[model samples]
Target: MIFFDRVSKVYPDGSVALQNVTLTIEPKEFVSIVGQSGAGKTTLLKMLLAEEIPTDGQVFFESSDVHDLGKNEMNELRRKIGMVFQDYRLISGKTVYENIAFTMEAAGKTDEEIEQDVPHVLELVDLSSKIWNFPKELSGGEKQRVAIARALVNQPDVLVADEPTGNLDPVNTYDIVQILKRINDIGTTVILTTHNKGIIDSLGKRVIVMEKGKIIRDDKQGKYFI
Candidate 1:
């Protein structure tokens, strides 16, 4: 389970990024968070990853307080979470296979494991045929698929996608959303932050709406309502 207990973040400049926000995300659940820009969506994800420290309260993953972990402990904790972003952060110089393999290598997986798992994830993203292609050679949607494959190669417990389909066309956006749904169906917890109303309405999953750094609404089966 992931829990944010009355968390608040105030930057050094005294800007409030989050204020008294409390949320709970159960395991294997698919949750969507929607709000306008600066509504604290990114800040909330950063807090969970320990990229941003909260001014008050705590963020917990399962039973561990995320901010209280040691260096090695934090690294272990981070391995349980995978992140996908709006920009497909693929390495320009690496092939699709290499991009995914790099993540496994960093996690200390052996060469044999990398060879086996890389193709499996690429297959999951339907990009096996493009394994040798570089990021420059793939289309935007394909690149995002590769990004998703890289994020999932390690099989993290939670997958956080922040505006994942922001740059795609309508057809591509629908494909990306379907891919996200398939990932959730496989029992990986998914936390998605998006502005696409069509995607949100089609999901019919738990939706949490935020504004001014506070949760304004939470619905069991929700649409995109600001």
Candidate 2:
């Protein structure tokens, strides 16, 4: 569903975030990207999202070159990719329902659609009862769940989770991982970048390990090796 063809990114001041990274992510596949800090894991995700233009090579999403798209085209393409971050990134004033509703609202969804889909996605993240709560009221796990629900509100073809479990305890991390797995089981392509060794080993899925801005290892049914 996504391809990075010899992509490289060099920052101003002579820094390289990625170096000739080539990868293919199949549809409905759950892929984990594991690496230490500054290993280029996040850069790969940025390339997919077209958030950073590669200094060389191309990035393709379902056959369309992402870097070649215009503003409006990029906007349209981005609607098909959902992103979850290490930080919850929720609006402090928005209720759980409103936080999820905000994305749909931005997409020009109607009140009826928002009414129907918001509750469904909340249920998917197992936070149906917290719909009325604010961000400050939830635990770290709950906040991340809300972030996941917000990301899924659009029903994107691929979900990119960048360190989604970074701030939670083991039990909460397990819960979040299970939620991600459930989403993948239902056919959403999941791209997760995490630092947790236990999360990687427990996944037992395809793993791509990065080092010094390059892909060092790619394994199917892989475990934590970094």
Cα-based TM-score, every candidate: 0.97, 0.97
Candidate 1: regions farther than 4 A off: none
lDDT of 1 by residue, 81-140 (tens): 988989999999999999999888878899999999999998888889999999999999
Query: TM-score of model 2 relative to the true fold?
Result: 0.97
User: RMSD, each candidate, Å?
Assistant: 1.0, 1.0
Model 1, TM vs. native: 0.97
Error of 1 at 142 (Å): 1.2
The lDDT of each candidate is 0.94, 0.94
Relative to the unseen true structure, what is the C-alpha lDDT of residue 172 in candidate 1, on a scale of 0 to 100? Answer: 91
Error of 2 at 193 (Å): 0.5
In candidate 1, what residue range of length 10 has the lowest lDDT sum? 73-82
lDDT of 2 by residue, 101-216 (tens): 99999888999999999999999888999999999999999999999999899999999999999999999999999999999998999999999999999889999999999999
Which regions of candidate 2 deviate over 4 angstroms?
A: none
Error of 1 at 78 (Å): 1.6
